[model samples]
Target chain A: MNEQRRDVLDLLAEGKITATEADQLITALERDQPPVASSSDTRPRGRAKYLRVMVDTLDDGESGQINVRVPLQLLRAGVRLAAVLPPQVLERANAGLSKSGLPIDLTQLKPDELEALVEHLDELVVDVDQPDAKVRVFCE
Target chain B: MPQLVTVRVTRVNRRPVRIWVPVLPVVLVLAPVLVLAVLAAAAACRVYRISVARALGSGWRVISALPGTQLDIGLGRSAVLVTIR
Candidate 1:
Protein backbone atom coordinates (compact mmCIF):
# COMPACT_ATOMS: atom_id res chain seq x y z
CA MET A 1 0.00 0.00 0.00
CA ASN A 2 2.18 2.78 -1.26
CA GLU A 3 1.03 6.37 -1.27
CA GLN A 4 0.19 6.28 -4.98
CA ARG A 5 -1.92 3.13 -4.60
CA ARG A 6 -3.66 4.57 -1.51
CA ASP A 7 -4.43 7.74 -3.41
CA VAL A 8 -5.96 5.76 -6.24
CA LEU A 9 -8.12 3.75 -3.83
CA ASP A 10 -9.14 6.92 -1.99
CA LEU A 11 -10.22 8.49 -5.27
CA LEU A 12 -12.30 5.42 -6.05
CA ALA A 13 -13.97 5.45 -2.60
CA GLU A 14 -14.80 9.15 -2.92
CA GLY A 15 -16.48 8.60 -6.32
CA LYS A 16 -13.98 10.88 -7.99
CA ILE A 17 -12.82 7.97 -10.16
CA THR A 18 -14.54 4.75 -11.17
CA ALA A 19 -13.31 1.38 -9.94
CA THR A 20 -12.08 0.50 -13.45
CA GLU A 21 -10.17 3.78 -13.65
CA ALA A 22 -8.64 3.15 -10.22
CA ASP A 23 -7.55 -0.29 -11.30
CA GLN A 24 -5.95 1.09 -14.44
CA LEU A 25 -4.24 3.84 -12.47
CA ILE A 26 -2.83 1.35 -10.00
CA THR A 27 -1.61 -0.83 -12.82
CA ALA A 28 0.08 2.10 -14.45
CA LEU A 29 1.70 3.10 -11.18
CA GLU A 30 3.05 -0.40 -10.71
CA ARG A 31 4.39 -0.41 -14.26
CA ASP A 32 6.10 2.94 -13.74
CA GLN A 33 7.85 1.96 -10.51
CA PRO A 34 11.06 -0.04 -10.55
CA PRO A 35 10.76 -3.62 -9.46
CA VAL A 36 11.50 -4.24 -5.79
CA ALA A 37 14.57 -6.34 -5.18
CA SER A 38 14.15 -9.58 -3.30
CA SER A 39 16.84 -11.49 -1.41
CA SER A 40 17.76 -13.58 -4.45
CA ASP A 41 17.61 -10.61 -6.82
CA THR A 42 19.93 -8.60 -4.57
CA ARG A 43 22.58 -11.28 -4.53
CA PRO A 44 25.48 -11.01 -6.94
CA ARG A 45 25.15 -12.99 -10.14
CA GLY A 46 27.48 -15.62 -11.72
CA ARG A 47 27.66 -17.86 -8.66
CA ALA A 48 27.25 -20.94 -10.85
CA LYS A 49 30.07 -23.48 -10.42
CA TYR A 50 29.72 -25.96 -13.24
CA LEU A 51 28.58 -26.31 -16.83
CA ARG A 52 26.65 -29.51 -17.46
CA VAL A 53 25.80 -31.40 -20.62
CA MET A 54 23.38 -34.30 -20.70
CA VAL A 55 22.13 -36.54 -23.47
CA ASP A 56 19.83 -39.53 -23.57
CA THR A 57 18.68 -41.49 -26.55
CA LEU A 58 16.82 -44.65 -27.31
CA ASP A 59 17.21 -46.64 -30.50
CA ASP A 60 15.51 -49.94 -31.26
CA GLY A 61 15.16 -50.93 -27.60
CA GLU A 62 18.72 -49.81 -26.84
CA SER A 63 19.38 -46.77 -24.72
CA GLY A 64 22.41 -44.53 -24.52
CA GLN A 65 23.28 -41.61 -22.28
CA ILE A 66 26.11 -39.26 -21.60
CA ASN A 67 26.66 -36.68 -18.86
CA VAL A 68 29.50 -34.24 -18.33
CA ARG A 69 30.14 -31.54 -15.75
CA VAL A 70 32.98 -29.08 -16.16
CA PRO A 71 33.94 -26.51 -13.55
CA LEU A 72 33.68 -22.88 -14.63
CA GLN A 73 37.01 -22.23 -12.95
CA LEU A 74 38.65 -24.53 -15.46
CA LEU A 75 37.48 -22.30 -18.28
CA ARG A 76 38.92 -19.24 -16.54
CA ALA A 77 42.21 -21.02 -15.97
CA GLY A 78 42.33 -22.14 -19.59
CA VAL A 79 41.88 -18.59 -20.76
CA ARG A 80 44.71 -17.49 -18.49
CA LEU A 81 46.87 -20.24 -19.86
CA ALA A 82 46.10 -19.06 -23.37
CA ALA A 83 47.20 -15.57 -22.38
CA VAL A 84 50.75 -16.80 -21.83
CA LEU A 85 51.09 -18.66 -25.09
CA PRO A 86 53.36 -17.30 -27.82
CA PRO A 87 51.81 -15.05 -30.44
CA GLN A 88 52.47 -17.56 -33.19
CA VAL A 89 50.79 -20.31 -31.21
CA LEU A 90 47.81 -18.12 -30.54
CA GLU A 91 47.55 -17.22 -34.21
CA ARG A 92 47.56 -20.89 -35.11
CA ALA A 93 44.93 -21.61 -32.47
CA ASN A 94 42.75 -18.81 -33.78
CA ALA A 95 43.03 -20.15 -37.29
CA GLY A 96 42.14 -23.65 -36.17
CA LEU A 97 39.21 -22.43 -34.13
CA SER A 98 37.94 -20.40 -37.05
CA LYS A 99 38.27 -23.37 -39.33
CA SER A 100 36.19 -25.34 -36.87
CA GLY A 101 33.39 -22.73 -37.15
CA LEU A 102 34.35 -20.77 -34.05
CA PRO A 103 35.65 -17.32 -34.94
CA ILE A 104 37.10 -16.60 -31.49
CA ASP A 105 40.42 -14.83 -31.23
CA LEU A 106 42.51 -16.22 -28.43
CA THR A 107 44.68 -13.09 -28.41
CA GLN A 108 41.71 -10.89 -27.61
CA LEU A 109 40.59 -12.97 -24.61
CA LYS A 110 40.95 -10.88 -21.48
CA PRO A 111 39.91 -11.48 -17.88
CA ASP A 112 37.12 -8.94 -18.16
CA GLU A 113 35.81 -10.47 -21.38
CA LEU A 114 35.96 -13.94 -19.85
CA GLU A 115 34.09 -12.76 -16.77
CA ALA A 116 31.40 -11.18 -18.93
CA LEU A 117 31.09 -14.36 -20.96
CA VAL A 118 30.73 -16.42 -17.79
CA GLU A 119 28.09 -14.04 -16.48
CA HIS A 120 26.13 -14.41 -19.68
CA LEU A 121 26.57 -18.16 -19.57
CA ASP A 122 25.03 -18.15 -16.10
CA GLU A 123 21.69 -17.49 -17.74
CA LEU A 124 22.18 -19.69 -20.80
CA VAL A 125 20.29 -22.92 -21.24
CA VAL A 126 19.82 -25.17 -24.27
CA ASP A 127 17.35 -28.01 -24.46
CA VAL A 128 16.32 -30.36 -27.24
CA ASP A 129 13.53 -32.90 -27.05
CA GLN A 130 12.70 -35.48 -29.69
CA PRO A 131 10.52 -38.52 -29.83
CA ASP A 132 13.28 -40.82 -28.55
CA ALA A 133 16.08 -38.49 -27.46
CA LYS A 134 16.71 -35.62 -25.08
CA VAL A 135 19.59 -33.22 -24.62
CA ARG A 136 20.29 -30.39 -22.22
CA VAL A 137 23.07 -27.96 -21.52
CA PHE A 138 23.10 -25.49 -18.66
CA CYS A 139 25.14 -23.99 -15.84
CA GLU A 140 24.63 -24.70 -12.16
CA MET B 1 38.29 -28.97 -0.79
CA PRO B 2 37.34 -32.28 -2.30
CA GLN B 3 39.58 -35.13 -1.13
CA LEU B 4 38.54 -38.13 -3.15
CA VAL B 5 37.62 -39.29 -6.64
CA THR B 6 35.25 -42.16 -7.26
CA VAL B 7 35.02 -44.27 -10.39
CA ARG B 8 32.34 -46.82 -11.03
CA VAL B 9 31.86 -49.28 -13.86
CA THR B 10 28.87 -51.53 -14.39
CA ARG B 11 28.18 -54.27 -16.86
CA VAL B 12 25.02 -56.13 -17.75
CA ASN B 13 24.13 -58.87 -15.27
CA ARG B 14 27.27 -58.09 -13.27
CA ARG B 15 27.92 -56.25 -10.00
CA PRO B 16 29.13 -52.67 -10.13
CA VAL B 17 32.82 -52.16 -9.46
CA ARG B 18 33.78 -49.07 -7.53
CA ILE B 19 37.22 -47.58 -6.95
CA TRP B 20 38.01 -44.84 -4.42
CA VAL B 21 41.14 -42.75 -4.91
CA PRO B 22 42.43 -40.46 -2.17
CA VAL B 23 43.45 -37.15 -3.77
CA LEU B 24 44.67 -35.17 -0.79
CA PRO B 25 47.69 -37.32 0.02
CA VAL B 26 48.66 -37.44 -3.63
CA VAL B 27 48.34 -33.72 -3.94
CA LEU B 28 50.40 -33.17 -0.77
CA VAL B 29 53.13 -35.45 -2.03
CA LEU B 30 53.25 -33.67 -5.37
CA ALA B 31 53.14 -30.17 -3.92
CA PRO B 32 56.90 -29.81 -3.74
CA VAL B 33 57.39 -31.19 -7.21
CA LEU B 34 54.72 -28.85 -8.55
CA VAL B 35 56.44 -25.85 -6.92
CA LEU B 36 59.70 -26.79 -8.57
CA ALA B 37 57.97 -27.27 -11.89
CA VAL B 38 56.31 -23.87 -11.61
CA LEU B 39 59.65 -22.28 -10.87
CA ALA B 40 61.18 -23.93 -13.92
CA ALA B 41 58.19 -22.93 -16.04
CA ALA B 42 58.44 -19.37 -14.76
CA ALA B 43 62.06 -19.25 -15.84
CA ALA B 44 61.11 -20.55 -19.25
CA CYS B 45 58.34 -17.98 -19.55
CA ARG B 46 60.78 -15.22 -18.59
CA VAL B 47 63.01 -16.22 -21.47
CA TYR B 48 59.99 -16.04 -23.78
CA ARG B 49 58.99 -12.58 -22.48
CA ILE B 50 55.75 -13.97 -21.01
CA SER B 51 54.38 -13.11 -17.60
CA VAL B 52 55.79 -15.58 -15.10
CA ALA B 53 53.26 -14.71 -12.42
CA ARG B 54 50.30 -15.24 -14.74
CA ALA B 55 51.60 -18.58 -15.90
CA LEU B 56 52.13 -19.82 -12.37
CA GLY B 57 48.79 -18.50 -11.25
CA SER B 58 46.98 -20.13 -14.15
CA GLY B 59 48.68 -23.45 -13.52
CA TRP B 60 47.63 -23.42 -9.89
CA ARG B 61 44.12 -22.38 -10.80
CA VAL B 62 43.78 -25.30 -13.21
CA ILE B 63 44.98 -27.81 -10.65
CA SER B 64 42.82 -26.43 -7.84
CA ALA B 65 39.76 -26.36 -10.09
CA LEU B 66 40.02 -30.04 -11.03
CA PRO B 67 37.72 -31.17 -8.25
CA GLY B 68 33.94 -31.40 -8.71
CA THR B 69 34.25 -32.54 -12.33
CA GLN B 70 32.22 -35.53 -13.41
CA LEU B 71 31.63 -37.67 -16.49
CA ASP B 72 29.18 -40.47 -17.18
CA ILE B 73 28.64 -42.62 -20.23
CA GLY B 74 26.11 -45.38 -20.69
CA LEU B 75 25.31 -47.70 -23.61
CA GLY B 76 22.88 -50.56 -23.56
CA ARG B 77 23.51 -52.31 -20.24
CA SER B 78 26.97 -50.97 -19.47
CA ALA B 79 27.89 -47.71 -17.80
CA VAL B 80 30.95 -45.83 -16.60
CA LEU B 81 30.99 -42.92 -14.21
CA VAL B 82 33.83 -40.78 -12.93
CA THR B 83 33.27 -38.21 -10.18
CA ILE B 84 35.78 -35.95 -8.47
CA ARG B 85 34.70 -34.53 -5.11
Candidate 2:
Protein backbone atom coordinates (compact mmCIF):
# COMPACT_ATOMS: atom_id res chain seq x y z
CA MET A 1 0.00 0.00 0.00
CA ASN A 2 1.05 3.61 -0.61
CA GLU A 3 2.19 5.87 2.22
CA GLN A 4 -0.94 8.03 1.93
CA ARG A 5 -3.17 4.97 1.83
CA ARG A 6 -1.39 3.56 4.85
CA ASP A 7 -1.63 6.84 6.70
CA VAL A 8 -5.35 6.93 6.00
CA LEU A 9 -5.81 3.39 7.26
CA ASP A 10 -3.84 4.19 10.39
CA LEU A 11 -6.10 7.16 11.00
CA LEU A 12 -9.14 4.96 10.58
CA ALA A 13 -7.83 2.29 12.92
CA GLU A 14 -7.12 4.87 15.58
CA GLY A 15 -10.84 5.77 15.53
CA LYS A 16 -9.96 9.31 14.55
CA ILE A 17 -12.17 8.83 11.50
CA THR A 18 -14.81 6.46 10.19
CA ALA A 19 -14.34 3.99 7.32
CA THR A 20 -16.32 6.13 4.90
CA GLU A 21 -14.34 9.19 5.93
CA ALA A 22 -11.13 7.29 5.27
CA ASP A 23 -12.35 6.42 1.75
CA GLN A 24 -13.17 10.05 1.00
CA LEU A 25 -9.76 11.18 2.22
CA ILE A 26 -8.07 8.53 0.12
CA THR A 27 -9.95 9.63 -3.00
CA ALA A 28 -8.92 13.23 -2.51
CA LEU A 29 -5.31 12.21 -1.90
CA GLU A 30 -5.22 10.07 -5.04
CA ARG A 31 -6.49 12.88 -7.23
CA ASP A 32 -3.48 14.99 -6.26
CA GLN A 33 -1.02 12.05 -6.24
CA PRO A 34 0.08 10.12 -9.27
CA PRO A 35 0.87 6.40 -9.15
CA VAL A 36 4.26 5.05 -8.26
CA ALA A 37 6.62 4.19 -11.13
CA SER A 38 8.69 1.08 -10.57
CA SER A 39 11.70 0.00 -12.58
CA SER A 40 10.76 -3.68 -12.46
CA ASP A 41 7.56 -5.10 -13.87
CA THR A 42 6.26 -6.32 -10.52
CA ARG A 43 7.51 -5.58 -7.05
CA PRO A 44 6.37 -4.28 -3.68
CA ARG A 45 7.44 -0.64 -3.90
CA GLY A 46 7.31 2.62 -2.07
CA ARG A 47 4.72 5.29 -2.76
CA ALA A 48 5.44 8.00 -5.33
CA LYS A 49 6.59 11.43 -4.26
CA TYR A 50 4.33 14.47 -4.77
CA LEU A 51 3.42 17.89 -3.43
CA ARG A 52 1.17 17.28 -0.45
CA VAL A 53 -1.62 19.88 -0.20
CA MET A 54 -2.84 19.90 3.38
CA VAL A 55 -6.20 21.60 3.98
CA ASP A 56 -7.53 22.40 7.43
CA THR A 57 -10.64 24.27 8.52
CA LEU A 58 -11.21 26.27 11.70
CA ASP A 59 -14.30 27.88 13.15
CA ASP A 60 -13.90 31.17 14.98
CA GLY A 61 -17.08 32.56 16.48
CA GLU A 62 -19.41 32.41 13.47
CA SER A 63 -16.78 32.62 10.77
CA GLY A 64 -14.90 29.79 9.02
CA GLN A 65 -11.36 30.00 7.67
CA ILE A 66 -8.95 27.72 5.85
CA ASN A 67 -5.18 27.74 5.34
CA VAL A 68 -3.23 25.86 2.70
CA ARG A 69 0.41 25.50 1.62
CA VAL A 70 0.82 24.34 -1.96
CA PRO A 71 3.82 23.49 -4.11
CA LEU A 72 5.09 26.26 -6.38
CA GLN A 73 4.32 24.13 -9.44
CA LEU A 74 0.70 23.67 -8.37
CA LEU A 75 0.46 27.38 -7.68
CA ARG A 76 1.67 28.17 -11.20
CA ALA A 77 -0.87 25.76 -12.70
CA GLY A 78 -3.74 27.31 -10.76
CA VAL A 79 -2.73 30.81 -11.79
CA ARG A 80 -2.72 29.83 -15.45
CA LEU A 81 -6.11 28.10 -15.36
CA ALA A 82 -7.77 30.91 -13.41
CA ALA A 83 -6.80 33.38 -16.14
CA VAL A 84 -8.96 31.68 -18.77
CA LEU A 85 -12.21 31.11 -16.86
CA PRO A 86 -15.33 33.25 -17.34
CA PRO A 87 -16.50 35.67 -14.62
CA GLN A 88 -19.49 33.44 -13.91
CA VAL A 89 -17.21 30.74 -12.44
CA LEU A 90 -15.86 33.10 -9.82
CA GLU A 91 -19.31 34.51 -9.04
CA ARG A 92 -20.92 31.09 -8.71
CA ALA A 93 -18.02 29.70 -6.69
CA ASN A 94 -18.38 32.45 -4.12
CA ALA A 95 -21.87 31.00 -3.44
CA GLY A 96 -23.65 34.35 -3.79
CA LEU A 97 -23.06 38.05 -4.11
CA SER A 98 -21.33 39.56 -1.13
CA LYS A 99 -23.33 42.24 0.66
CA SER A 100 -20.09 43.71 1.95
CA GLY A 101 -18.84 46.50 -0.30
CA LEU A 102 -15.47 44.80 -0.59
CA PRO A 103 -13.61 45.63 -3.78
CA ILE A 104 -13.65 41.89 -4.57
CA ASP A 105 -17.34 41.70 -5.35
CA LEU A 106 -17.82 40.52 -8.91
CA THR A 107 -21.57 40.72 -9.31
CA GLN A 108 -21.39 44.49 -8.86
CA LEU A 109 -19.29 44.86 -12.00
CA LYS A 110 -20.31 44.72 -15.69
CA PRO A 111 -18.94 41.97 -17.91
CA ASP A 112 -16.35 44.24 -19.47
CA GLU A 113 -15.29 45.47 -16.02
CA LEU A 114 -14.66 41.97 -14.78
CA GLU A 115 -12.75 41.07 -17.93
CA ALA A 116 -10.46 44.03 -17.42
CA LEU A 117 -9.76 43.07 -13.80
CA VAL A 118 -9.00 39.47 -14.76
CA GLU A 119 -6.37 40.67 -17.20
CA HIS A 120 -4.50 42.27 -14.32
CA LEU A 121 -4.72 39.42 -11.75
CA ASP A 122 -4.00 36.53 -14.07
CA GLU A 123 -1.14 35.39 -11.82
CA LEU A 124 -2.91 35.41 -8.44
CA VAL A 125 -5.90 33.05 -8.67
CA VAL A 126 -6.60 29.31 -8.70
CA ASP A 127 -9.83 27.46 -9.44
CA VAL A 128 -10.54 24.53 -7.07
CA ASP A 129 -14.28 23.86 -6.91
CA GLN A 130 -15.68 21.98 -3.96
CA PRO A 131 -17.34 18.64 -4.57
CA ASP A 132 -19.81 18.81 -1.65
CA ALA A 133 -21.41 21.00 1.01
CA LYS A 134 -19.21 19.78 3.85
CA VAL A 135 -16.20 21.54 2.36
CA ARG A 136 -15.95 24.76 0.37
CA VAL A 137 -12.62 25.75 -1.15
CA PHE A 138 -12.03 29.47 -0.63
CA CYS A 139 -8.81 29.65 -2.65
CA GLU A 140 -7.67 28.28 -5.95
CA MET B 1 26.11 2.97 -5.52
CA PRO B 2 24.26 5.37 -7.81
CA GLN B 3 23.51 4.11 -11.31
CA LEU B 4 23.55 6.44 -14.28
CA VAL B 5 21.60 6.07 -17.51
CA THR B 6 22.70 7.49 -20.84
CA VAL B 7 20.33 9.07 -23.36
CA ARG B 8 20.82 10.70 -26.74
CA VAL B 9 20.09 14.43 -27.09
CA THR B 10 18.96 16.32 -30.19
CA ARG B 11 19.43 20.08 -30.42
CA VAL B 12 17.60 22.34 -32.87
CA ASN B 13 18.60 25.91 -33.65
CA ARG B 14 15.97 28.57 -32.84
CA ARG B 15 16.72 30.83 -35.83
CA PRO B 16 14.22 30.76 -38.68
CA VAL B 17 15.41 28.43 -41.46
CA ARG B 18 15.39 29.21 -45.16
CA ILE B 19 14.11 26.52 -47.50
CA TRP B 20 13.81 26.43 -51.31
CA VAL B 21 10.56 24.84 -52.44
CA PRO B 22 8.53 24.33 -55.60
CA VAL B 23 5.28 26.30 -56.03
CA LEU B 24 2.27 24.10 -55.28
CA PRO B 25 -1.38 24.49 -56.29
CA VAL B 26 -3.43 27.16 -54.42
CA VAL B 27 -5.24 24.62 -52.21
CA LEU B 28 -1.98 22.88 -51.16
CA VAL B 29 -0.21 26.21 -50.62
CA LEU B 30 -2.80 27.46 -48.11
CA ALA B 31 -2.69 24.23 -46.07
CA PRO B 32 1.13 24.23 -45.76
CA VAL B 33 1.16 27.93 -44.84
CA LEU B 34 -1.38 27.39 -42.05
CA VAL B 35 0.58 24.34 -40.81
CA LEU B 36 3.82 26.30 -40.73
CA ALA B 37 2.19 29.17 -38.84
CA VAL B 38 0.98 26.73 -36.13
CA LEU B 39 4.39 25.07 -35.89
CA ALA B 40 6.14 28.42 -35.50
CA ALA B 41 3.75 29.57 -32.79
CA ALA B 42 4.17 26.29 -30.89
CA ALA B 43 7.97 26.51 -31.05
CA ALA B 44 7.93 30.06 -29.70
CA CYS B 45 6.53 29.00 -26.31
CA ARG B 46 9.19 28.41 -23.61
CA VAL B 47 8.13 24.91 -22.68
CA TYR B 48 9.10 23.67 -19.24
CA ARG B 49 8.76 19.92 -19.06
CA ILE B 50 8.70 18.43 -15.54
CA SER B 51 9.01 14.75 -16.09
CA VAL B 52 7.09 12.32 -13.86
CA ALA B 53 10.37 10.69 -12.87
CA ARG B 54 11.66 13.98 -11.51
CA ALA B 55 8.42 14.86 -9.75
CA LEU B 56 8.24 11.51 -7.97
CA GLY B 57 11.84 11.81 -6.78
CA SER B 58 11.14 13.49 -3.45
CA GLY B 59 8.32 13.63 -0.93
CA TRP B 60 6.94 17.12 -0.48
CA ARG B 61 6.32 18.54 2.95
CA VAL B 62 3.10 20.52 3.56
CA ILE B 63 1.75 22.78 6.26
CA SER B 64 -1.78 24.17 6.42
CA ALA B 65 -3.97 26.43 8.59
CA LEU B 66 -7.70 26.36 9.20
CA PRO B 67 -10.17 29.16 8.64
CA GLY B 68 -9.77 32.05 11.10
CA THR B 69 -6.24 30.75 11.64
CA GLN B 70 -2.70 31.46 10.50
CA LEU B 71 0.60 29.55 10.30
CA ASP B 72 4.20 29.88 9.20
CA ILE B 73 6.51 27.10 7.94
CA GLY B 74 10.27 27.03 7.59
CA LEU B 75 13.28 24.75 7.95
CA GLY B 76 16.91 24.88 9.19
CA ARG B 77 16.56 28.05 11.28
CA SER B 78 12.79 27.62 11.56
CA ALA B 79 10.05 30.07 12.49
CA VAL B 80 6.31 30.05 13.18
CA LEU B 81 3.88 32.95 13.12
CA VAL B 82 0.15 32.73 13.78
CA THR B 83 -2.38 35.55 13.62
CA ILE B 84 -6.10 34.97 13.94
CA ARG B 85 -8.69 37.35 12.58
Q: Pick the candidate with the highest DockQ.
A: 1
Q: In order, what are the TM-scores of chain A for the candidates?
A: 0.60, 0.25
For model 2, state the Cα shift of residue A40 in Å.
45
Candidate 1's DockQ is 0.61
Provide DockQ values for all models, in the order shown: 0.61, 0.03
Which is the leading candidate under lDDT? 1
Q: lDDT of model 1 at residue A3?
A: 95
* Candidate 1 residue pairs in backbone clash: none
Off by over 4 Å in 2: A1-68, A94-103, A106-140, B1-85
Across B4-33, the per-residue lDDT of candidate 1 in tens digits comes to 999999999999999998988877889999
**Would you estimate the TM-scores of all the predictions?**
0.69, 0.18
